[model samples]
Structures are given as structure tokens and as C-alpha cells.
Target: MSIFSGLQPPEAFAEAALALGPAPLVACHNDADGLSAGAILVKTLQRLGTEPSTRIVGKGENAYSDAFLDELRGRAMTGLVVTDLGVSSRLPDLGLPTVLIDHHVPTGVPTHACVVSGIEDDPIPTSSLLAYRCAKAIGVETGDLLWLAAIGLIGDMADEDGFPEMEEARALGITALRKAVSLVNAPRRTASGDASAALGLLLKADGAKAVLSGAHAETAALLQAKEEVKAALDAARKIGPKVSAEVALIPFSSPCQIHPLVAQAWRTRIRDRIVIAANFGYREGWVHFAARTGEDRDLIAFLAEHRPPGAGEEYGNGHRLASGGALRLADWNHFVHAIGFGPELEAAA
Candidate 1:
């Protein structure tokens, strides 16, 4: 069972992959999953005799923005392939054919684009796995890259083990988790190139050892980030547990901006309760929130039900268990009270 077992790529995708002789522009996100998806697509394109030109979205930016559109317009491309990103509310018509392979909740549907997303019925699979299956469907032999999909799955924290679609990806040992972490943190460790060098490494590396060994700085950064998160979680654990409450809140303030990863780690430690961790940067007059909750306390649904002041629906988006968004400094107290957090608790201990 492949993650893409029954799902089919859009007709435009197959036409562009097979008939369009010119190389395609593959724009992807900078995260580990996005890089993995980008690498898989790059390999598939090369095997089909067309080398793809890869572009990465910057941190804290959406995939479809004015700058990105301007860059796309400058390229002499025949077709476009977007993976692990396409949640933009405003997608400009690029005139050229496009393929969107992603699992994120779409903000708006693009015209003249073939979207391959897992929004309605099927279990969400990482864009990397989806792209690999799409490549295979188009007659590219991608047998060796099944393990790569596992890396994306781990990086995205998308554990679809029980789902029928992820049978093959789940079969691959979870060793890629460490490698995924390295790939994710590499860009954060360096000021320049962000995920550019790391994406190149992933695309060219022979195996997990090659990637992990090459990402020394990234691994160290990840370790430090984890330690910081552990410290925060440990302090939160000392706070009295609320057995009657549906959610547990951990508000923190740190110089480092790693709320999403910290929120995930905190969720793992307190799986029995819904976890909401807010990282406040008072200087910026905003607080970024990362929440983890089960189906009973679906984070996405809660975000949808409660719109933060001065923010749109697009501001809060992600999976069922994990979601994130930001709020203004003025709204912080209101948001906290809305989520049932008391005012007396100290944000940082």
C-alpha cells in the first residue's frame, strides 16, 4: 500500500511531465518535509531527462506572495511544480500549467492548477510521499526513494501508521527521525543559505548517514533547541495539574523563536491533555501560539471557532492535533482567558 495508492495526479501534471520538453520550476518550503519533497521531485525530473530548477520559500512567509510571483515570472519555465506549500489565499494566475502537491489545508483554490491534496476523505500524507507516488505513476522508476518519504513524514510529524495509504512508508524504520531533525534545524543554525545547502545535501546524499553526518551544526542546534524546550516543559510540569480541565496551558517567553517544535515536545510529554503553548515577544507586541490536541479537542477546529483579534482564518492553520497562529499583545489576555488559562500563572518560571 502506497501513500498515493488511489490518488491520481492532475492531468496537467502528467502532460507537463511527459509532453512538455522544457524544464519545470519546482518551488517548495524550507522545512524538512518540504526539502524532502523538493528532493524527490528533483530526482524524478532528472530521471525523466529534465533537470528542475528549485526555489525555496523564506521563513515566516507563505509560498504564494508578490515577491515569489515576481521571481517566477523571471524564470524561463515551461511548467510549475509546487510541493509541501500552497496554502496561500491569493494565488496569481501564472499562465503556465501548475501542480500543487500538499497536505496542508488550502486557503484558496488556484485557477489552471491541478491540486493534489488530502483534504476531504483520505488520511493526510506528506507532500514528499505524494510526489514520489506521482513520479512513479508518470513512469519514473522511484523505487529507491520510498525511504525518503519516511523522512518527510517524520519531519512533518505526520504519523499515519494505522492508515492504509501509509503502509509502505510506515514499514521503513523510524531512524529517519534523527535525520529529519537535523535537516529541519540546519537552516536555523546558519544565517545564510538557510535550507538551501541542506536541500542540496538531501538531494545528493546517498543515505541517512550522509545527511546526518553532514549536518553537524544543525544536529547541535537541534539538541540545544530540544534542551531549551525540555527545560520549559520541566518547569511547566511543576505547575499543579488540572485533572478536570480539557486543556493544559504553558505560556513561555524565550529569546529563540521555536514555539512549534517546543509545542510538539510539550504535547508528547502531556499527551493526556490538550496542550497550548504561547511564546510571547512583548517587544514585538505579539504572541505566537502552538497548540496540540486530539480529536476531542481538535486544535484546528478550535482555532476556526475562535478567531483571534486582528487576524484572519489563514493565520491559524495546521493538522487536527497541532495548529498555530499569532495574536496581538492587547489580545493576549483575552485569548488566554478565552482558552481558560488563569491570569495569575507566570508565563515564564
Candidate 2:
């Protein structure tokens, strides 16, 4: 049976909804996967006869900050749904009925009433898929949301071989969705600039149709941006592999619109190798890394084990063999060295 099959909206989820009995508030991560997951949850809740206000808390590592939690608390939310985030730390203090749907390995399960994450049993299913299942358990169906779900899977790097069901689902009709997500996710001239644009679209988009249309339009822009970034990455790849040393630092920048694509391209080229890529943004910074091929190099485990003291698990993902993180420029060297890439790069430097 599919891993997703076992996922049922826990009784606590419905009870929590019933307890709220009216408009609830939702907080979700602010990326393609998180936004997609949030959309699914929101639509599902609406279908179940509840209208909820939704907010994007930000992206990656900052998604689950104490400030975000305080903001939600200030809203007097009766019930809270957190998607694509691991809020184990804040759960104890949240003091409200909550449901958490996430895909990353848990730092610890929330003591809250309902916590559903892929890490519990199935490592293969994406959080979107899990959220879809949870939605179904609560009598909320979103067949139209499949495309967003697929995007979340890809964005979360949950495309491993075991997820044949997800692959098959993606094959059904996800080209447009992928393009849409790619567009919003494409790198930009500035980190905050494109992110701001993407967040605006997410906030304004009404339903699946709107999301699909808006994403498609944005994707066209993304493709154009991708072309430019791809050219830069291609050049970097050509020069990058020849740097016969322990660490190969590929520092290059493109319009922020194509950053994700550039990161994806780098992942492909540096398979099983330790590589770091950074894009300088006008107001913010973006960094990505991959450990493609190596001997017993479990990049995901490495990051999970050594993530910075205060950094949340929201910004990182990988299996034992591969892992990646989004970091601010200030902590760039710290993370780079944490992954043991610094010593390796000393020779190259």
C-alpha cells in the first residue's frame, strides 16, 4: 500500500476544528512547497465548512521563528494549522489546538494534539501528499490541488525511487504545475525581490485555477530568467569540475529569478561531490550546497546533526546520501565548515 494511504486526519484534527467552530488561522512556510501545502490545507478546510485566514511566515530557516509564533498568538487563533514546517520547539508554548503537517525528519514530535509528518513512518511521501491525505480524512477533497502537491514534492526533493505513486501522479498532469512553480521559484535579480513577488502571488491567488494560471504566467518569466542563469551555471560547471581539490567553491550570481534552477543544475553536475553555490541578492542572500557522490557521505544526516544552534529544520532536507540548506550570507562560512567543506576547500583556496 502507499505510504500516503495510512495517513488519516487524526481525530484530534477534526476535534480541533470543531472546537474552533468558526474562522481559524493558518501559518505556513513561505516557499513553493510550503505555499502549495498551505493552499491545499486552506482549500480543504474551506471545503469542510470552515473559512480560515492564512499567512505566509517567511521562507526556509525563519519559517518557524518565535516571532512568527507570537504573531499567530496575537491573532487569537482558535485553531492553527502549520504546514511544511517543523514547529516542535514552539508547540509546547503554543497553548492552542494545532495540527502540523510536515515532511522533514523530526527534531521531536510536537506534544500537541495532532502531528502528522512523513518522518513518523514513511520517509518517501512528501508533506503535500501527506497533507492531501489528512485533508481527505477530514472530508476535504482537492483533486485540483494535485499539481501544487507535485510541486511541493519536487521542491522538497522527495523524488526518490520509492515514491512511484507520487511519480505516477506527477506523470498524470504536472508539466504545467512544474512550470508554474519553477517560474515563481526561479532565481531573481534579488533574493527578497522574487520572494516578495512569489509571496504576493500566493497571497492573492484564490484557488487552484488562480494558482495554476498565475504560476503559468510566472513560469514563462521564470523560463526566460532560467535561460540566463543556466548559461552562467553551465560556464561555472565547466570551470568548476577542473578545480581538483577537496572543495570546489562555485560563487556566481544571476538575476534572482533563476536561483533555484541554477541550484538544481549544480546539483546535477556535482553529483556525489561536495559543492557550494551562492547568489548575492540586492537585499538578502541565498546559498545552496550538495554532496552528490561520496563514500558514506550522508549529507542529510550531517546537516540534521550539525544544524546551527538556533536554526530551524525548516530550511534543510536530504536523505542519507544527499542534503541541502538555505542560509544567510553571514553564516555562510559557519555552515560551509560544518559540512567539512572548508578544510577540503583550503587546498583549492
Candidate 3:
């Protein structure tokens, strides 16, 4: 029999999740969607058999990063399940059965791994919903977990995708789910970029109400994170953008991950140009930026044309219209120059 009972990539992925046995390490991204997905798998794994260990890939770290893979080495894991992290052939060979569950456009899919991608879906399913399907295929009663997937849908702004489950969840309480998502997203946006508290709340909370009830200590942490991020965002929003004919570059330095929000804030206002929000202070020795365009331009191809030498997988790796990346100071300077910006925004070497 096939490991996933002869199903295809995605359906097989759900089945593989159920079969990946003894002890698998579930590595997930550190955003609201990622954490919710991880939480679902963690819950499902617990109900199935032995509990699975989980690693939340946070700021400046990816599942295949050397530091991350080093942490996985020598662990007594029998399998690996990765969610929400972007797919790439750079996936390290850890000599174990692996499954990748994601919605990001794949640059390359590892041949040895089972990839469940909803990237081509008209309305892409978030990793949380994908993990929920895994839970169902495991034959566990997942009525409670449906709301968990709803939390991710709202977090990723897919609440309007019109999935029946989303409507059912909305009837449960959209306001609460929205609030919980913001809270969950806040911790990882802060300078510390630690999402442990957010993950902790998701892992144990019975539902959205439990997440926001102020009943758990982690809830307080999330609230504080929200306040910190809001202040940072307000400060970033105050700065004006340097507009060119075709692109608007809004450059600000902050410890918060506010570049995406800043770019989003400008995409509507500028309407005629691609809005690039660059945050040079989010991490040391790197410039992180997000690109948003009002038009239907293919940003990934646009970025590839002006690609910087130092740009890695972090560059132009998201959806075609909505993508961004990190570049070293030198490469960022090269990028700004290549895009027709003068020396004013270039970093001092």
C-alpha cells in the first residue's frame, strides 16, 4: 500500500500526516496562520498516538536554515511535517519521511517529500485549513478543530473566501476570531519576534473565546504585544513616502515587522505605482521590504529583473502580486539603484 494509501500529493499529504509515525517534528512558520496550523497538527498527533514535537520558525529563520536544521540533527524523530513555510528544493535531507503543507507558490518541490500545495487553488486554502483536513483524514472527531481553521482563515484575510466552514465559524463569532488573530499576530511582529506565547495559547485554548478571555497568562502577553506593535505601526505610518513615477518607496527603520502594513497602507493611496515599504531596523545587517501594487503586475518577475546578487529565498518568494524579500545592505543599495532611485536612499558602505 502507498504510504498515504495511494492518494495524490495533497490528499496524500493528509493521509501521510496520519501515517508519519512514532515521533515527527512539526515545523511551522511563526505567523497566526502558521501557528494555528501547527496547533491543529499537534492536537491531531496527540490524539493519534505519541505526541509530536513542534518548532515554530520565527524571524530570520526558515525550516531549511542551517541553524534550524542543526537543531533537528540527532533528534530521535521518525518523520517531519512542515507547514506554512515556503516550499523550496533547498529542503535539507534529514533522512526521514517528510511532508510539506503550504499555499505559497513553490520554486521547487523536493522529490523525496510529499508536498500538499493549494497554491494553484482559485482561492487558496491557508495552511490551517489544510492541517484541519489532515485531522479529519486521521478519523478523529474534529468538530472543535473547525474553529481553529477559521481562526487561520481570518488571520490570512481569507474569511471572505466563502468556505462553508468559514460561514459556520462566522456564525460562531467573527469578531472574537478577528480579535484573536490580531493578538496572535502581534507577538511575532514585535522586535523580539518570539511567537511562543502565541503558540502556547493556540495549543491549549478551546476556542476563540478561550484565546481572548484573559483567562490565560499568554493572553496578557498577546495583548501587550498588540499594544507595542500598534505604537510601532503608528510611528511608521507617520513617515511619508518617496515617490517616483512608477514606484513609491516608503523607507522607515523600526524593530516591528510593519513594512507589509506600511506598503498596504500606501497601495490604495498611491494607486498608480508599486509601493515598496522598506524596514532597515527589523533585523540587524539586513533590509526587509514588502511590495504592494494596485495594478495586476507580476511582482515576482518584476523583482527578478532587478534581482540583487545577495538576495536569497527571502526575495520575491510570496504571491506574484504580493511579495517581498530581505537583502544585505550592499545588495539593497544595488537594488535601489537598479530600480531608478538616486543615491539618497542608498546605505553608506
Candidate 4:
């Protein structure tokens, strides 16, 4: 049965996955949870006797973009599985069979694909968890994949949600799992933004210890990437926030993707206001920001109200409490000015 967080029926999504031919493309986001989900999907498809091709959608890349479509067209593929990346409301229909597995708050429903979303579930399951369930529903060897679900759980900060799967996986070893998550997440957050090392580890490792055992070359790469991001974060953390009304904006520039970590670090101290950590150096010509709030307010709605004209579908698309987006320098200027920050706060053109 297709339990995919208990929202979809058994026939809803599994049928679509089963319909796909041998050469299906699995496109997933570049993160610990996303990579874990991709690995799970790979194992599932392999069990079904198909050799699937996996692609990592790095930061700033969209799976549904025209460029992505063009790339997909160039490949000889019969099916597609998109995971972790948020979907466009007006999702385009891929001609071949498709299955979308995700847990983010979707903007709209896709009419053409089997969407296995966990948005409705209380304490929503992460993408890897959903993939695990889907694998189980289709009658695969999920017993060995439990630790993967645990890695995604710890990575997404949902380890405290108390899922039985987590408890079971924890028995295998939680420290290694958490460390594996940090290592697996490191490569994607570095300046290179290549998560192949992390994904490769997930694809081959039998368990959490196997990932951190230093037995594979991928493990060394992951460790190096973690140290790189750590240095960048140390420099960015020294800068404090500039508060305005209920918003506490901490603006800094870093090549590493540490804005989310910065926002989270300051989130507790600025418990009364929304914490926004904006980074100008993560990507050229754009400002990347992460919003976190201790206040029980709808950050998505908050962003919608203050969203600058230039902000596209990329903005305000994550969870209600923690959401962020990238904006061009010009649009970012408008956003900061509108939010009552001065010109000095705007991204330099």
C-alpha cells in the first residue's frame, strides 16, 4: 500500500513508479536528506530490475527549468523521479511516467504526475522517510535501509519527532548517523556545491558507521568540505543583527552556504523577532537569505506580504516557520528598503 505519510492510497503513486521503464532519471536536491532519499529511490528502482540514473540538483538550479527540460530531452530515459526540491505550482507535465516525492509545502498540485507529498502529516516526514515508506509499500528490502531514513531525520532536525523508525535506526548508532549527516551535508554547502561525495557515500554504504568509517575516499572528501564550511561560518558568525520592528536582520557575506546556520544560531536569541541571515557572497549577482522565527507566526505569509517585486517562485516556498529565497541585487535592494533597512544593507551591485 502506498502510505507515503499516510496521505495517498496504495495505487496512487506506486502504480506510476511501477509503470516506468528501465532507464528512469532520479533528480534530487543536494543535501543530506535529499541525497539519502535519492539513494533509497535508487535501491527501490534496482529492486524492480531497473538501472536508474541519478542527478543532483545543486543550489540555484531548478528541476523544472527549461534548461533542465532540455537536458532531460537529451537523455535516453523512459521515466523521472523528482525528490526534495520544491515543485512549481504550475508544474509542467513531463511526457514520460513520473513520480514526485517531497515534504515541502507545495504551492499547487500537478495534474500529470503521481505526487507523493507528506505536507499534510503532522510533524511531516522528511523526503528520505517518505521514500522509505514508498519502498516498503512496493515490497522492497527496506529492513537494510532504515538507517538512511534516520540520516534524513537527523539532517532535517526532525529527530526529536519520535518516529518508531528513528528509534529502530538509533539502535544501530545515532552518533555516527548525525556525524554522517554533517559530513554528507558539507560538500553541497561548500563553494564548489558538488555533493557527489556525499551522494556516492549514501549509495554505497551499508549503514551509518560505514559512512563515517573512513573506509571510502568519499568520506575524506566529505570531511574536507565540512572543515571548509566551518571556517566560513566562523567568520560570518561574528557579525550581529540589525533589528527593525519585529525583524532582526543579520547581513553578512560568505562563500559557504552558512546563512541558514547563522539564522538558526541567532534564532534563539532573537526569540521575539524573525531572524533573517542574508548572504551576498554565496552566489554572485544575488542575495541568499534564510528566515527563522521563534514567534509562532506564518513566515510564509510574512514573506508574501513583504516580498519585493523581483522575488520569483524561489522565495517563501519552504516550511511555514523556516523559509527563505534568493533575489537579484536590484530586487534585494527593494526588499531591504521596504523592510526598513537602509541602503547600506542592500547588496552591492
Number of the top-ranking candidate, with lDDT as the measure? 4
Scored by Cα lDDT, where does model 1 land?
0.64
lDDT of 1 at 210: 56
Model 1: runs farther than 4 Å from truth? 1-12, 16-23, 70-76, 86-89, 158-193, 213-247, 255-257, 268-273, 282-285, 328-334, 340-349
Query: Which residue segments of model 3 deviate by more than 4 Å?
Result: 1-9
Give the alpha carbon lDDT tens digit for every residue of 1-349 in model 1.
5433223353335555664346888888777778888888888888888868998875445566577678788889878888887554366577877778887776666656667765554566778767766776777776667666667766765655454334665554456555554556456323232566667767766556656664444444444544554564455444443322567766666534456656666677776777776666422566767788643666777776666576743356777777877666556666666666666532331
Better of 1 and 4 by TM-score: 4
Clashing pairs in model 4?
2-10
Candidates ranked, most accurate by lDDT first: 4, 3, 1, 2
TM-score of candidate 4 relative to the true fold: 0.96
Sort the predicted structures by TM-score, highest score first. Answer: 4, 3, 1, 2
Error of model 3, residue 281, in angstroms: 0.6
All candidates' TM-scores? 0.76, 0.71, 0.95, 0.96
Q: Rate the local accuracy (lDDT) of all candidates.
A: 0.64, 0.56, 0.86, 0.86
**lDDT, candidate 2, 182-221, per-residue tens:** 5555433233334444544544554334545734455345
Model 2 has how many clashing residue pairs? 14
TM-score top scorer = 4
What are the per-residue Cα lDDT tens digits for candidate 4 across 1-349?
3323233532355677788899998999999899999999999999999999999999777776787777887888889898898755455566889788989887776767778887877779899998888888888788988998898989999999988888888889889888899899999899989998898999899998999999888999988999999999999989989998878999998888899999999998989999999999889999999999999989999999989987877788899889998899999999988878888898879
